[model samples]
Target: MIDLRSDTVTRPTEAMLESMREATFGDDSRDGDATVQKLEALAAERTGKETGAFMPSGTMANLVAMLAHANRGGEVLLEDGSHTLNAELGGIAGVAGLFYRGIHGKRGAMDPDALREAIRPVTRYHMGTALVWMENTHNRSGGAVLPLAHMQAVYGLAREKGVPVHLDGARIFNAAISLGCAASEISQYSDSVCFCVSKGLSAPVGSVLCGGAAFIERARAYRRMVGGNMRQAGPLAAAGIVALETMVDRLVEDHQTAKRLAEGLTRTDASLCDPKDVETNLVRVDVRKSGRRAAQWSADLKSKGVLVAPADLYALRFVTHRHISAPDVDAAVGAFAELWKKS
Candidate 1:
């Protein structure tokens, strides 16, 4: 089956699996696992951060960052469609006791002016804002790359206000590849950053959170509080190490395959949004004019061995990943064309 559902669906490569099997396990809570330490150091060096910590999932990494940055009752500024706001089960409010000030953004990229206006003043009788959160290659926004200049502007504004910025960079490597820039360029604009190795990188599990040593120390404590500390996490970290070392540069191939898919979809139906909007590994199709519900369309595609995700009642999404090659994309496109014709 051609699985265009999500990047997170990718399985680990044979090499990654072998690395995991050969990893030397040690106690993470006591002596600290060597593989985990090596992975953290490599991730920190790549992102140009002072320190890094490994978490089991992107959600935990994001939660750790949010908990470390904001105090109880403090507010955090975020895009309305951001993963931290919409996808993390409201952990910021439920666990951290922080309020969210959601500002709507175009294509999941917030305007600097909108972000500035979202910040609450200390005199506002509320807990006041403490942090600003940004997501790159935003999941809900068709994997849009948040422009570096815009991020710099927002970070500058937050720094002026003495508010820290935490970046939810789950697919940030995709953004960096798309922009032809180093990932560290984006890291420079954030006080803290979290990214997933399990996504496009095709690792079995793990995410990395990076920042200054003090902030990471606090985040580690929060991670433990949330019962996220694993005793022998080296096996997972070994896969993450391989992902960081080997899987990043190949993202350009995924982006190219996504463009091919987008082109095919647009040729099948021009009523959908322009294919130019598909800049990374995700393609969002507006199926409103097709006179078919998204769930029904998805089910139909699944029956034909071409899996995809329903974005809404009238929209759907396709995410190209490492497991999907150029030929697989062509086949999926053919499936989409046939389905559109039948519809």
Candidate 2:
């Protein structure tokens, strides 16, 4: 079956598996693993940060970053649709005791002007702002890439008030490819950044959180507290290294495939999806107009040997990755057309 459900469905490549098999191993919890250390340093340098720590998942990486940057009861400013606000199981508020002000922004990015106003002062009545959060190639916005200028504007405002900025950069590499810039160019505005190797990068597992040296040290402590510290994790890091080395440049192909799929959807039924909304590797189809719930459409399509995810009651999300070729995209589009006709 062609699984467009998510990029997380991608299996590791032969090269990635080979690296994992041949990787040098040591205890990572005690910082004795040479391979994990190398992956962290490379991730740090790639994102223009002083240091980085590898974590089991993007959620843990984000949680550690929040714990390190903000105190209990502090506030964080972020977009309403961000992964921190919508996903991550409310760890920022529940686990970290940090209140987040979710600002409504177009295409899943917080507005700079809104950010300036939302930052709280040292008022006894309100929890003051400790962090500003940004998401690039935002997931909830159909993979819309936040422009560097927009990030710079928000970062400038946060810096003026001495507030630290954290980026939920799970898809930052995709954003870089979309915007024709390096991921570091997008990450430079934030004090801390996290990106997943398991997502579009197609590594079997792992995410890296990067920031200042002291901040990374603190995050590592939180990582241990959250039960995220792992020993002998070099095999995973070895695949991550292979992903970074070989997978990134091919992301543009995934983007092109997604665009092709979106265009095909318009051919099936323009109201099923708007090709204009296709950005990066995510194509969010609006199922509301078809008088069918997103889950129903997802199930119907899956029976046709094409799998997709129901992001909400009204929207279905399809993601292109290393496993999904151009032919798979066309077949998925054809399945959608068949489903719509039966409706």
Candidate 3:
């Protein structure tokens, strides 16, 4: 099947497999593994941060960031459709002991004026804003890339309120390629950032959280508290290192394929998707006009040898990665068109 469900389905490359075979197996939780340290340093250098700590997943990295940055009952301000609020299973409140205020946004960017109104100082009546959050290539917004100018404005406002910022940059490299800039250029606006190597990057497992040395040191303790410390994680780090070195540049190809798929779907039915909305490797299709739920569409397409995920009642999310090709995109589009005609 042409698996357009998510980039998380991507497998490791041969280079990553060979590196994992020869990787050092030192204990990371005790003395710190050499391979893991190397991977962390590389993650830090890429995101323009002083240091980084390896985590088992992006969810853990984000939870650790929240735990390290804020006290109990503090508030986190982020876009309403953010992955943290909608997808991370309420870890922000349940585990981190923080209250979250979802700021209204468009295409993953928070409204500057709305954000200005939301940030508050500690008072007996309200829990003050503790952290300002941002996400690049935001998942729920169909992989929308937040503009740098918008980020700067939000960061400036947060700084004025004496609040620190955290960026969920799981697809920062995808955002960088779409904007024609370095990942650091995007990450510079936030106090801390985390990115996953297991998604479009094609690493088997791992995410890295980067920030100031002291902040990362604190995050490491929180990482342990949240059960994120992997004792002998050198093999995973080895694959992540290879992913960082060799997999980033090719993400543009995935974006291109996604655009191709979107354009083709639009040609079949304009109500399905707008190609312009597809800025990266994800395509969010609106199937509300078809009088069929997205879950139904997903199952129909899967039966025709194409796989996709239902994002909501009337929306579907299609993701492209290294394994998908131009021909695969055309086939998926054809299958979708066939179903559209039947509907």
Candidate 3, residue 140: the lDDT equals: 91
Question: Pairs clashing in candidate 2?
Answer: none
lDDT of 3: 0.96
Model 1 C-alpha lDDT versus the unseen true structure: 0.90
Clashing pairs in 1: none
Question: What is the alpha-carbon lDDT for the whole of candidate 2?
Answer: 0.91
Candidate achieving the largest lDDT? 3
Alpha-carbon runs more than 4 Å astray in model 1: none
Write out the backbone clash pairs for model 3. none
Residue range 1-343, candidate 1, lDDT tens digits: 9999999998999989999999979988889999999999998987889989999999999988989988899999988889888778989999989989888798887866778777776775777888999999898889999999888988989898899999999998999999999889988999998899999999988999999999999999999999999889999999999998899999999999999888888888887657789899999888888899999989999988999999878889999998898889888878878988888
Q: TM-score ranking from best to worst?
A: 3, 2, 1
* Descending-lDDT candidate ranking: 3, 2, 1
- The C-alpha TM-scores of every prediction are 0.97, 0.98, 0.99
lDDT of each residue in 1-343, candidate 2, tens digit only = 9999899988899999999999878998874799999999999989999989999999999999999999999999999999888889999989999988899898877776777889977687987999999999899999998888899999989999989999999989999999998889999999999999999888999999999999999999999999998899999999999988889999999999999999999897788677777779999888887899999998899899999999889899999998999999999989899888888
Local error of candidate 2 at residue 308 (angstroms): 0.5
**Total clashing pairs in model 1:** 0
Displacement of residue 61 (Cα, Å) in model 1 is 0.6
